[model samples]
Target chain A: MTGFTTTESLAAYMPEQNIDTDAIYPARYLLLMEREGLGPYLFHDRRFHGDGTPKEGFILDLEPFSKAQVLVAGAGFGCGSSREQAVWALTGFGVRCVIAPSFGEIFAGNALKNGLLTIALPEEVVARIGAAAQRGARFRIDLEECILCVDNEIVATIDLPEGQRMALLNGWDETDVLLQEEGDAISGFETRHRMAQPWLFQGST
Target chain B: MGRTLYDKLWDSHVIRSYDDGSALLYVDRHLLHEVSTPQSFIAIEKKGRSVRRPDANLAVPDHVVSTTNRHLPIADPLARAQTQRLVENVARHKIPFIPLDDQRQGIVHVIGPEQGFTLPGITLACGDSHTSTHGAFGCLAFGIGASECGIVMATQAIRQQRTKTMRVNLVGLQSPFINAKDIALAFIARIGANGAAGHAVEYAGPVVAKMSMAERMTLCNMSIEAGARVGLIAPDDQTFDYLRGRPMAPKGEMFEHALTYWRTLPSDADAQFHRELTLDVSDVEPHVTWGTSPEDAAPIGARVPSPEDLTEATRRERRRRALAYMDLKPGDPLEAIAIDVVFIGSCTNSRIEDLRAAAAVVAGRHVAAHVKAIVVPGSGLVREQAEREGLAQTFLDAGFEWREPGCSMCVGMNGDRLEPGQRCASTSNRNFEGRQGVGGRTHLMSPAMAAAAAVTGRLTDVRKLMGGKP
Candidate 1:
């Protein structure tokens, strides 16, 4: 993994509402042996024509957006399905941050865990983010600072839970929760299971 | 001290809470699919962690793979690979799996309930939003993120916050034609989409009691549309009887003991609730959504809401936005809205009964030339049963496509999608913009209503369409 965070903004353009994980990465791509090659195929089935020609009119095919590192989107931008591949696809497509008016409840959780930033602005601010992208304004986000810098002006401030913030900063996964407990939980679970509810673990084949 | 469902469920599972808010939730069941598990298992390999609860977890390949002949090669290479990864991962981890071609292979939500693995009074988490459908058995089920899925896989526990408890009392019985889908839509119309936010909803009352298990499941499945984490119905004889003799259900004495325990899991009469809502069965009619979001729904008799009538700041804004995207006019009769497509399927409303109900509407009538209608089964079993009853042929004769399952057009996961600017009458849950494909508009309705739309190519009352049909 690269040690440095890329400071570029990705022009994440989507038609409004319920942008599902399947569109982010089609189920067909799930066959790929590795996550490494999934980025280019992100929205491949949609953005590419049936004959494999690029859909010239599609938003992701436009210049700068094709290279966008940050995405600004509309309401419920990631709703419907709970596939975390949506998060991986966005991240793999070089989007470090996604600014949407609203996010699907589960998709936001996925983005939080996978070191991607999902910022919730009001509908007005979401439009402004997209506008800022179109105008080629420098939209710099300070994940630790909670500030979205657009054209050197602080356009938005977002808040995340401090623990999630720390996890995102360090790319920590679920095991970090257990590691934080420092080996106390297992013994405590055994004691609790044995003493109070021995029957829970009583079954045997 | 708070007794929100989040707390009750949390307290039972917490090993301990750190200085932070998160704690380990003892996940009773973990259901996975081909798509999410491959990367997680890879992540597990990278971490050298073995799955802790292989017995408690289950995996299946539903999304991406075609539901056509099992022996036929998957046309989509990526789907084939993900499915293979899942198969190998299950084999390596020794977790039980229902692979393609397996009799039990279906959408995870459908397979789990039919197999009786989704039981009462237990916590169920899957990497799919429709996991909430399992709540019909009185279990608290919701979709957990993939990271949480991995957490559950490695330790059989994940951190959590809980939801407040809410009761949706469904009083009285519906007329012969009324159904659980109508009641569920009525609930959304009354409460609004975010009405039950951060709540665990329980559906009760005589209307609920009269509902078949499939009907109850349809109601519980859409609780997420109301922003509830989980929706539950009390475990009753109906639930117990449904569980008896199922392949995965407890055997002999174990079954009797489990039934007794499950019967005890219902909310006691004296139990207090944080929030309560009541809906008269007589109040609900065949339902559909005219605008975006599940909440923008109304009964068949109601007209589309004008923005001026939505005086609430949030609603006014939402209504205005919905009007723009849906191209719907205020005061337009929701019944008058023409539909280009009618889709019948999804984890929400694709059981055999839904098919039979839809078939009853479309049996003698041919679909309007302008309407493109399709029916997808929720599982292979449903597809087989639907065929055995000649329901598929009825649909086919009525000019509707009889397609394979796997959440088809419900989320537009596969190639089956509504074209841009197409308006559809759908039996799936959400009506949020682009839910069934980009630029596609959905008017959520019952299966019968969808069938009516298929015949007339518009949102017509199903009862009227039922006039001549058997």
Candidate 2:
């Protein structure tokens, strides 16, 4: 995963709310083992015809927005399924960041691990950005400053937890980070937990 | 000052809390299915790490396995490889696996509780969004991504930010026709899709208290549809009675000891919640989704909503798109809408109770000649139990195909899919576009409701078919 510091890119807006993971990456392609090159299948039904031709009028299929690396989406983006391929497809399609009013809990967590920045702003702020995005506006998301900028003017402030911010800025492997800091703590907890609930360990396997 | 069930579960599992407000949580159980484990297993092997608690993990191949002819090889090479990868990964890690042929093999969510792997007050994690199904046992269960799966396998711990609590109190007597599936859909419709976003929802009150373990699991399974990661009903006598003789539950003295702890798992009377909503189940009717999103649901008797009724542009546009995708128009009666297929299975509603419900509606009745209906039990055990009870025979007699245990038409991952433009009445948790097939239109409803649709070839009120006693 690449460390995220700042990125300025054209934003594509999706006006639909509750854009579920199933719609993002269809269930049929779930068996594909390889994560890369999933861009072709992103929004397969909505973006392409059965003949595999790109559908006209789709924001991602249209020029300018086709190259967009930032997506300004609706509320509750990525709301269904825990398929990480949804994130993989977005990243593979060159999307580096997504700004929405809210996100599915599992989708947001998956986004961070794949180096896709997900910023949850208030609904009004997200709407403002989305409005600018529809007009082919280019936005800059500054992780270091935790602000969203359009035309060098601050439009919204991004409030990410410090740990998430640090993790993004440094590309920290979460398992390594957890093991390095809380390895002993986890061990201690397990010892006490086992003692407290011996039934949990009683020959279940 | 009292603690909610979520608070109790969270406090018990915390290994350490970081200044950033994220806590390291130790997971007591991790369930793995084929689709989500391959990438995690590869990541762990690359990192030179081994599963920290092999015994804490269980693996099953459900998502991509062929639901028919389990003895024959899987025809789709890609799906076959995915299932094969799970087998190899589990064997290498020594994780307990329920292979496709095992009678215990089923949807991870259904079998978790069935085997007593899901217990009250323990934290469980899975790579599927429906992991919240286990929360019916009062566990702090939630879904994780593949990377988080690797973290759990490597360290037996996951970093999580605390979620505020939401208490959904079902306050009135439920109508006979309104099952947990209706309650789930009703709740999602009341609260938009993101109603419970970032909050842990504890289902409480008389309605939830009276629901069976299967019904509670069905309700909690769809909690993710409302955007809640965790959905719990505090463990009660129903939970204990369900787990008493399960294969993995504590035995004898150990069971007694566990019971003492389990008895304390419910929220206190004065427990505080960040958000609270009281719903009167007496007024709720059998619900079915008319649009793509679960929130786009209404009573089976209602008409399709007009997008113009929505004031907000985004919401209006969403409604328009959903209507267009579903081929539905404003003022169209939901019950009059015809369906091409009926599916009565999935982790959400494939338990034996669900089958019995469908079978009761199907007994001595034939499926509509034009409709293709199928019943896929959640597990082999469930399949056996249903067969023993003659529910399988009843479905077969009704012209519904009785298939093996797997996530069949719900996901359509194993080649059991609807053709393009086909409409279906499904008991699955999700009704998203292309969820069952590329161009399939899904109307999410209860199993009995789906069975009614099969018999009528249209979305009909199950209560009418049940002779007014659903």
Candidate 3:
């Protein structure tokens, strides 16, 4: 997990809402345990035709957009399914940040865990970014300042929760937080809770 | 201030809170499945950490296992490896496991409730999105990713921020043909896919309160499709009755004690919600999705919506893409849209009640010669119950393939899949492109609707076929 601070790249625009995990990476490819090499499989069904040839007009295949490391999308960007493979596929495809009006809760969490920054802006701002991306404009997302910029002009100031922002900035996994705990407090709480509610742990133990 | 059900649940589970509004919350039950657990187990082994609370975890292999022939080995190497990995990890950690051949072995969500593993006034987590299905018992259940699953496996706690509460009050008398699946679909269609995003929905009002436990499960099962992390129904007599004699339920005196606690799990009378919406289901027909998203749904008699009907340019573009992928036209009626296959099973609608509903529609009727229909129960217990009641024979006699329990055609991971250019009426939750198979088109609907589609060789209205006025 590499800490993310800033990235400037050509923005890829996918203007569809509810772009679900199935569309991100289809269920057929979910059998593999190894998460690597998923970039080519991202949107495989939509990006290619039945004969194993790339579709001619897909945005990812177009010039300039092919090198995009930032994605601008509509609302509900990663809805449906809790597959972490969707985040791995996006990161594997070199997308370091996703800008959307909103995102599916689980997908957003998965993205944060994988060090992929998910920025939620106002709908109008996202639409503007989408329009600008269509005109081949490069955009930058600065996590430290919580600002999105195009051509050195600040376009939108995004607000991310402090905890998530720090997690991405420090590349801190949840395990790292857990390891910081001394376990004495947790054990003390558990003992008191068990004594108070003995019935709760009856079947569990 | 009166707290909502979600607030009460969250407040009870908080072990410690941080300034960032996130809390370390205790998890009462953890459900594990094959596809999501392998990576988490590997990560734990790499960290040299053992499962902290094996007693709180229950493991099963359902996603990749073959739904046909229980005695045979899984043919797909990847699926076989995943199932084997789960078995090995569970044995190594001494977690409670239900093997494939066990009568109790079933879909994770199905087995949890049936075995008394999922109860009210507790918090549950699983690696699959449909974990919300267990919320039918008034539990705060939601899905988690692989890493989060690993955390829960190690600490029996999850870090989380509380979500706002949304109350969806279904206010009308539902028709007999309009089952819980129809209610869920109609609600999604009205609210759109992202309508409930960032909120926990508590279903109330006359329609929801009247539904059976199975029906309530059906309603909560598709909450993920609506972008809701959790969906709940207050515990009532139906929920308690359903869990009374289950194998894992509490014994005599303990049962009475548990019931006293369960009765107190409902939201207070004057509880306030962050958002409230009421839907009148008096005239909702048996609903089905005509396009890729669950929100792109309509009554069985309606035609597909045109891109022109959409006000937003992005939505119009999405509709155009969906139309091109589905090979469907704007004016084409949802009914009489010929389907190549009919799949009547998934976590959404594979319980015993769902099977009985489908069997009733196909009791003496034969399937269309051109259609391929299959019925996969949700669990081994469901399969046994169906067999005992002769529902399996009814399906087999109607030319529907009666198979064992697993997530078969709902997801195309297993051998069950549709070929290119094939269209299907599926009882599964998702209808995204290639969800059933690569290049496969799926129309989400209820079991009864799928059964009627199988018999008519097209998407037909179940009511019309049942001798009701169209």
Query: Which predicted model would earn the best TM-score?
Result: 2
For residues A76-189, what per-residue lDDT tens digits would candidate 3 score against the true structure? Answer: 999998988899899998999999998999999889888999988888888988999999887988999989897678998868778889889999767757746725555565
The two-chain DockQ for each candidate, comma-separated, is: 0.27, 0.80, 0.66
In model 1, the Cα lDDT at residue B333 comes to 88
lDDT of residue B366 for candidate 1: 98
Model 2 bad stretches (over 4 Å): none
Best-first order by lDDT: 2, 3, 1
Q: How many backbone clashes does candidate 2 have?
A: 0
lDDT of 2 by residue, A53-133 (tens): 877799998878999989988889999899999999999999999999899989999999988999998888888888898
In the predicted model 3, the residue pairs found to clash are none
Q: What lDDT is reached at residue B458 by model 3?
A: 94
Query: Candidate 2, residues B160-225: lDDT per residue as tens digits?
Result: 999999999998888876789999999999998999999999999998989999999998999999
Candidate 3 residues lying further than 4 Å off, grouped into runs, are: A203-205
User: TM-score, chain B only, every model?
Assistant: 0.93, 0.99, 0.99
Q: List TM-scores for all candidates, in order.
A: 0.82, 0.99, 0.98
Instruction: State the local distance difference test value for candidate 1.
Output: 0.76
Candidate 1, residues B167-272, lDDT tens digits: the string is: 8888976875677888887888787565675578988888888788899899889987776768888878888888888777676777776676666676766677
